[model samples]
Target: MAISKKISVLLNLADLLAKNKPEILRKNELDMNSFADMDESMKDRLKVDENKVDGMIRSLREVAEQDDPEGKILYDFTREDGLHIVNRTVPFGTILIIYESRPDVTIEAAATAFKAGNRILLKGGKESFNTNTYLTELWQRALSENGFDTHFVEYLNLSRDETQKLIKENTHNVDIIIPRGGDNLINFVTENSSVPVIVSGRGNNFMYVDDDCDTEMAIRLILNGKKRISVCNALDKVLINKNLPELKEKVSDFVSELHSKGIDVWGDKKAASIYSEIKETNDKMVLFEEFMAPKIYFSLVENMNDAIEMINRYSGGHSAVIVTNDAEKADTFMQKVDCAAVYHNASTRFTDGGQFGVGGEIAISTQKLHFRGPLGAQELVTNKWFVYGKGHVRE
Candidate 1:
């Protein structure tokens, strides 16, 4: 299909989705009801309400309005030898995205890929089967109505064994595989898939509070980061400067705010001394853990160097925040921290595609290869080289 036609189809799909909100909600409820044994965080990701439906519609429209990613000339030049060369963006041909829960990904991810002129294959978890199936039907309908092949967007509802077979055999010629889920799923796809994989969705994000930081603002940022425990960008660990004036008061205030929000605080020995209610944790492995619950790990750091080292060692390279008033220290932290998104005095919760103004994302890639942070429509395309040369013989 032509690029403009694809955008028109997406716009139509967005309107169709908005008008059929009741049907989508009904299908979502079936998926929600079937996952009774799932954890609260996973369940939160699975649920799709009116707000989520609206978000999906908005994302489709936003992506449709954006410039087409494919065939955009990135670089054009003529060599000294009179050879003209041009580099342009192109689709990856076939993209397979395997994710768990989050029904909105069905719309956003597919829209991004289709808008970029790529065929998308969605493999959603069984828990969201009903919703994913319904959404895929809508996509097919949109394509059919727009005089496009329904195969442009395909949904795979395969069992565990079947998934393994597909990944191992590469029967569909998937050019790239993106896994948007926890570590287990990402690791499974990376290890089993024959295609190139992009790992995403793990976020053991950390926040460091420097001695010169605004304590009140730090508390607010922490609260914001912890407000949504189900999201990957939610804060998981905190490191506070031990030399901060009134360190005890700061810790007390932070712990109190978290307590008010019904979140559990786990702290190291130094932090535990300030807040008696804080549970003590001695295991070093917990630092590497991504807590997708209302639980955060706290510790004490001597200085900025210590905080940077700790984050680089333990963070999932997702997002990190440093709450400091000193520009030099904040700049140093931002430069040294090995994360996809680094923040100074801001909440890590802003690490989202919509927040970044990319409509929506297929995933927040933790890997540093093809792309990092939000994988938006513009980031979905690969580059191609077009060279022009006359028939000339080389010496």
Candidate 2:
């Protein structure tokens, strides 16, 4: 399809969603009412209000306004034998995205793929069946209005056994698989998918406070990082420098702040020693766990190196941050932290595709294979080589 046709489809989808807000909310409410016993984070992801629908519309329009990612020339070469070669961006054909809840993904994520000229096969969790189905119907409507096939955006309401069989077998032609959920889902797709899988790993993001950092800024950033408990970028751990000024007093102040916000503060032995209010945990395995809740783990490090080592060892390879005033130290930390995004004096929550000005993202990719960081429309395409010759043969 032409770029204009693709943009028209996205714009039509946005308009349709805007006009169908009441129906969309009704579908989401039904899903929410049936799954009342779910956790706070799960409920948050499953719920869809006017604001969430507005966000979906905004993202779709943003994607439509941006330049198409496909057909961009990457390289061009010519040989003396009258042969020409060119490499250009091309769609990945079909992308199967399996996600849990977050009905917005049915709109926002699929917009990026559709804008990049790829067919999207959505496989949302059972909890979001109604909302996902309704949203996908809007997508199909937009596609049909543009004189395109409705199969371009399809929703698969499959059972557990059926999904597993499809994942293990290449029954449906899928180019890439993106699993955006917890470890169990990611592991299942990565282990069973016959096609390439883009693992949108856990959060478990970390932040380190340098001895030379601004105490107030560090505290503010840490607080903001935990503001959203349902996102993959939420802060889960903190590694404080042991030599920070007034370390004990500062720890107490931070702990008090966290408590005021109803956020649970867990601490290691040294961190607990600094303040008795910190719930102490001696288990080493907690460092690797992604607590998608109102909980954060705290530990003390000897210096920048120790902090860097601890973050690299325990983080989910998603995002890491260093709160420091020292430019050189911040640079070193940003360069050394092995994550898709590293921050200096900023909250890990800012590591998002929309925040980074990419409009919408298919997933916040943590793996290093096809691409890293936010997989936006531009990153969704693969390069193809085009060769031209007239009765040319190689000797």
Strongest candidate by TM-score: 2
In model 2, the clashing pairs are: none
lDDT of 2 at 162: 89
lDDT of each: 0.91, 0.93
For model 2, residues 1-395, the per-residue Cα lDDT tens digits are 69999999999999999999999999999999989899999998999999999999999999999988999999999999989999999999999999989999999999999988999999998999899999999999999999999999999988899889889996688999999999998998898888999888998999999999999998899899989999999999999999999999999989999999999999999999999999999999999999989999999999999988988898999999999999999999999999999998889998888899999899999989989998899999999999999989999
lDDT of 1 by residue, 1-395 (tens): 47789888998899889889999999999988887888989988999999999999999989988888989999999888888899999998999999878899999988988888999999998899999999999999999999999999999978888888888999889999998887888888888888898888589999999999899999999999998899999999999999989988878889989999999999888889888988998889999999999899899999989999999999999999999989998999999999999998899999999899997788899989989999999999999999998974556
The weakest ten consecutive residues by lDDT in model 2 span: 164-173
Q: Tell me the lDDT of model 1 at 393.
A: 50
lDDT of 1 at 338: 94
Question: What is the overall TM-score of model 2 with all chains considered together?
Answer: 0.99
Q: Positional deviation of 10 in candidate 1, in angstroms? A: 0.9
